[model samples]
Target: MGRFLLAIGAPPDRASDMWKRFEESGAMRLAVELEGVQLWSSVDLPLSIEPGGSRMILGQVRSRSLGDDDHPSGILPQHEQWPSWPKLIEAFWGPWLGIEYKHRSLRLELVRSADIEMPCYYALAAGGIYAASDADLLVAAGACTGEIDRAALASALVYPAHRPSSTVLAGITELEPGRRLEWTPGRLRGHALWNPWDFALPPAQIHDLQIAAETVRDAVLIAVRGCSAGQRVILGMSGGLDSSIVAAALRATGAQWSGVTTVSAEPAGDERYYARCVAEHLQVQLAEVPDNIERIDLRQCHAAHLPRPNSRSFSQSADKSMLEIAAASGAKAYLHGGGGDNVFAMLDSVRPVLDRALDTSGWAASQTVCDIARMTGRSVVDVALRAGRLALRHGRDAPRIGNSAFLSQSVLETAEFPHHPWLDTPPGARPGKVLHVNWLIGIQNFLEGHAGQGDLPYRAPLMAQPVIEACLRVPTWMWCTGGRNRAVARLAFEAMLPAQIMTRSAKGTPTSFLYDILEAKRDEAREMLLEGNLASLGCLDRDKVEAALGAVQRLMSGDVLALMRLIDTESWIRARIARQRD
Candidate 1:
């Protein structure tokens, strides 16, 4: 719900013109200009300027003992007097972006938790360092070039779940989480301020599960209550353990909340029964938005400014319907359990357990083997042998890049697609750390870049840093007990959630509905991809695209997701090209 543009080295006149262009784009509801930075934001953002100072803070900050001192304005005085600004910034919890100015030097900081969700993109253009929350805005303001970054585009196609720090525009780089960028005189520097991995501790060090569960519950309640304070909030209830836990926590706080869920006609895609169960248990009115696959429109779903195509296109109509209901209900913010799976419920992976066993004691290894045997219904000998093989095979490896049939050979050879760093990390380092980072980056990017475009502020209480850190402290064995994924979370809320929801193992799949939408709009997609801007740019092969369309017409089911990704990429490329020309 907030957007900002900052130019560090540009002349005053050029900065003013860029500000004017952004203001005219209808993207910002308020505009502010300081010595060198110009900030534009939506009305919902809690933007505060320091009294008689060039420092400003945007978004809400939450603390346990701070009381009203948690507000950014109240905390600014302490930060100003502190010797180390980065250390002070790192100690707080909340979603926020901060800007500080002194003696003509400008510094921009993105909170380590990335809960406030501000994507910063910068490039050396027009004789200055220009940065903005929106990448397209930087290009449109003539502060960044319009030329596409081929590597970034390829990365999107290959690794859709990973959020690359670099953007699709050449020479433009996104500020990574827990990082800061500063510009002064003729020099600019960027550095990392914090790393969550540094705080991770071995799960065995924390012996008590009850204490952990209580701590996690407290964190969730604090986050939910803190973010939804004095506001009408919408809870996205899916009847799953994650959403249900959030609903139960909100109900415990006695906050003003309503439930909204998307229901599909396809039984495989429907979860209304469970949703209704949760809503009834909470005694809250639930609004259902029927996702009729026939209403899919590629253009309507296309988010032109995003770095890549996302699930927004797949759920565009359904989300719009849900948003309409939320807006009509007078909600100020929409809350959901986005990162619950990544944080609380980690997937069952034996590699990390085996890796830890090999590096540590044999007693620990035996315990893990016994746990695996119990969970997988396999013999101890079999589990131990398998674990040994996995441990021996464990090493750094490059990510598996999927081959796109449509991408031009020349582009593929020349583009330096950035590799995912986690792919090279040691397996025994810490369980769920890599997955947590992936979810944080991916979800934050989607929410800020695409979902925040809605009328109300979109919030995720389950994604709070405190909750995530608490979950990370949980051992891998506890997460997947008895062959169940997210076992810890299920056990934590056993008394709060209904038996059906708390024990439900299977999740509803939307693949069928997605394919149906693609088939429903076959003709339009064909024309768009066959002669689309992406094909003209040599990013895709026209012949292969036509073949894919033919397969879709025949109801074939080979890599349909990849085909959809191609369509999304082409749609975004066409829209971006149009914007550049404008």
Candidate 2:
């Protein structure tokens, strides 16, 4: 991913002077300078400028329309195509950031697409707007006040995956994905380019699992082909259906690629059986890296340089091993089936049954209830009763943005947890659809990180826009059809997959490895949490934290997960402070 730093509306003098600052310490080189805009990019990707500069695109990008070539982040769509800004911006993908200069009403409006596939952040500081693909880049450039947003950090401990658009730094705000940010002289506003709810509603719903299968099948292929972009692809194979589909797509594109599966010491985390199946079936090279529990250092913060803490102790080995393989093989990015479960609506609640009953006649929906039963391993009577209650409520209620009372009452009382932008639903929205949209929210963190050039950045083609939109358009119940979760996805690629993968139901996870991290590093975790930076900032409850870690115990009551988040966040705070000192 090409790194970029953009300053919009800065004073002429500051814009000119910032060059020395970047040259001295920043990660990007100066790329563009307009009347009020100055852009810096890591790579000198050619600037796509409109004649005489009425419109322009700076930095590298890959579009759905042109996946084979990655450049020329599109010119603004004609009036006939997109009537809004976010819609105009949403077509591009990647943490590789870009800024489009579009002229409107004699005013220059530059909108950065920060949703779904791309990561963008903006802060109005020193009487101007500063934006960057990496948040720490902006901080390093002195574009932000550098004051930590403590409440935001506290909220992250409670809800890491769906943290609000605001960043931990007080002055910077992350641009929400699938939305547009509008900046005028002294004010800012937001507009959504698109949303999952649009397809979940009645008008866009598709009942045919067959059509849904075909749609996702094609979209994933296009996404993977485009993402491969002639670079040697490295597949993080888990031997699960999701990663298998990624392998199938790579084979279809005839791209140069290989696979790696992380094998855990414990049997539960071992999926080499299935990983072998995929590599042999497709006739591609495969590697197995040990998920070495001993390698996890609770103290090492590899992502400490990032704007937020992304390092989970258990993922450290897998991440490091992948990087080694990438360096050895000359791969720039790692592809996985990251969002397949969420996109395919593999949820635990009876929400799908509720949605099916509401969308189909009773006789037509009866079979779906049976399917839900088998898919979730619950009885038909229980599933129907839960779905019936959900229908009576017309699907308005929602679970809390996050759940964990790990924080002190003082923190919880004043925290003001943020709601997801999409949660503010329109009237008559289905409860199941709301939950479906939320499931998408849950997997977002998996797709993001500080993707440095040296790092083998993670890519999720299954979570691509067209692929997600296709899955969203299908009726939620359809995923649970045939007594299996993600049934549509299974059917979509059944012809391409080995029979074993097509029928495998037990997906692998690293929960056991995570527990191992906590157990092995119990003292380290206790010391970090009991007297760490977060407690000093009033983000953690010392008593509760001490009690949780004070005992050497099993992973119970989600306490271990909560404690790990605190440890991760604390490490990050220390790293951020240390960076400031440097």
Candidate 3:
């Protein structure tokens, strides 16, 4: 994996020290100085650097046709025929991020597709701006104070939602996906360069499921071909429709790919049977990594400097084992079906169908209401009443889902959690469009943060730009026909997947392992939360937290999830403190 640190507008002397600090963090293996910016990276990145222009392009690019018509239709020119310098930007596709330099200014841009992840965190320091791919590097360089942002912490603990462009540290900001930040002599401006919603087409414009399926299949194949060409690929097979489809696509391309799955001793948490079925159907070699909860080491479960809220404590060893196996197998990329549910398995809400039908005609609306009634096994009158109620309350704030009762009153009072932007979108907007936008943002944030954590490229073909656009253009009714989620996708891959695998609805839950982990480490967890920085900083009410921890065995699943979040927060804060002391 490649990481970068850039210091712009700093004095020449200060820039040198900043570079040294970055190197000392043990994260950077190479350092280079441009006009007014210093770039440091751990890997010798594939960067097309223009020293004179102070511009650099990191990662590979696939050629795109500009449709000049002077050239062959729909065919990309050879790399030799590509344009040079800034002009090359227009034809650039694939997983790439860029940094452009102007007169006393630096601009950093994350790719539109959010593949080849490069997360940038920035803070003002020493009369200049410093940004790094790692937040810990910025803190080490003295660009940020390292104080936890209480509001952000509260939001994470209480809302289960991450603020779009904010980090846990005060004054340190992360650049959102598909956004650019330009830092001039003494000012910085952030701009959104792409919006997935803009690609969404009205339902009236889409009429064929087969064409949609073909478009999606072609996009996935292209993405897999581009990413896994001439490389050993490993697929994380979950035996679900998403991963099964990806496996089938990889097989269709005649690529060298294998499947790996993590299985648990607990039957409830094990999916090895389903995984085996998919592997057998696809005719791929399968490797199983047994995640025995008894072998989990509590010390190794602690967060390191950075917080990974979505990660589970029991899966760390299994994750490391998978990475090691991939490395040993000479794998260049690991393909998994991330974001498949968000893009394809839309919610089966009646509101969207009702809205679309009403916009068309009364007969259409009544028919839709009847379909919904049949699908939901509710009376037509009841379905229509519920749809009307939903329509009336559209675009209004709903209740937050996370457990905030355990938070300290002071923290709750002072924290400013902004309402989700999607909730305020125009009421007349298609319900599917609104939901798609919400899921896109959440999934993009997740993939950018967690994917590609190790050296091997973790590619999600399902999240490819073309595939997401195609899925969005599909009507909502198709997604959840007959009250089945991801109906379109199921129909699309019916022939490639087994009936059992395609129609399987029961998802494996890791609750048994989670509860076991908590039980095994309950005492340590209690002490950590009670005496850790979270309590010391007044982010949590000690009494309530103690009670909750004491009642873990009796708590519901939702409460357990909330407690896990608290534990993660406490662990992260403790790690930050230890690093600061070091």
Number of the predicted model whose TM-score against the real structure is largest: 2
lDDT of 3 by residue, 1-582 (tens): 366676766777777776677667775755557676667777644555544454465655553322223221112333334344334433344555567666433544332224424456688887777777666767766787677776777766665554446767777876654556666656677665544544554632354767776666666666566556667889888777788888887887678889998876689878888889988888889998877655565444333534334334555555566677788788777888878888884555566565456446656667667766665678889878877787777632333444576688877776666454334455345665666656665665345323235466667878865566667777665565555667677777778887787778666766766677777788877877788777788877888778877777887776676666677666667666666777
What's every prediction's RMSD, in angstroms? Answer: 3.7, 3.3, 4.4
lDDT of 1 at 211: 72
- Model 2 whole-model lDDT (C-alpha atoms): 0.72
Backbone clash pairs in model 3 (N, Cα, C under 3 Å; residues 3+ apart or in different chains), count: 0
Give the TM-scores of the predictions, in the order they appear. Answer: 0.87, 0.91, 0.86
Task: Score each candidate by Cα lDDT.
Answer: 0.64, 0.72, 0.64
Q: Which model is ahead, 1 or 2, in terms of TM-score?
A: 2
Model 1 stretches astray by more than 4 angstroms: 22-32, 51-54, 64-84, 104-113, 201-207, 355-386, 396-428, 431-452, 541-548, 553-558
- The model with the greater lDDT, 2 or 3, is 2
Instruction: Score candidate 3 by lDDT.
Output: 0.64
**lDDT of model number 1:** 0.64
Model 2 spans > 4 angstroms off: 44-47, 58-108, 450-454, 550-553
Full candidate order by lDDT, most accurate first: 2, 1, 3
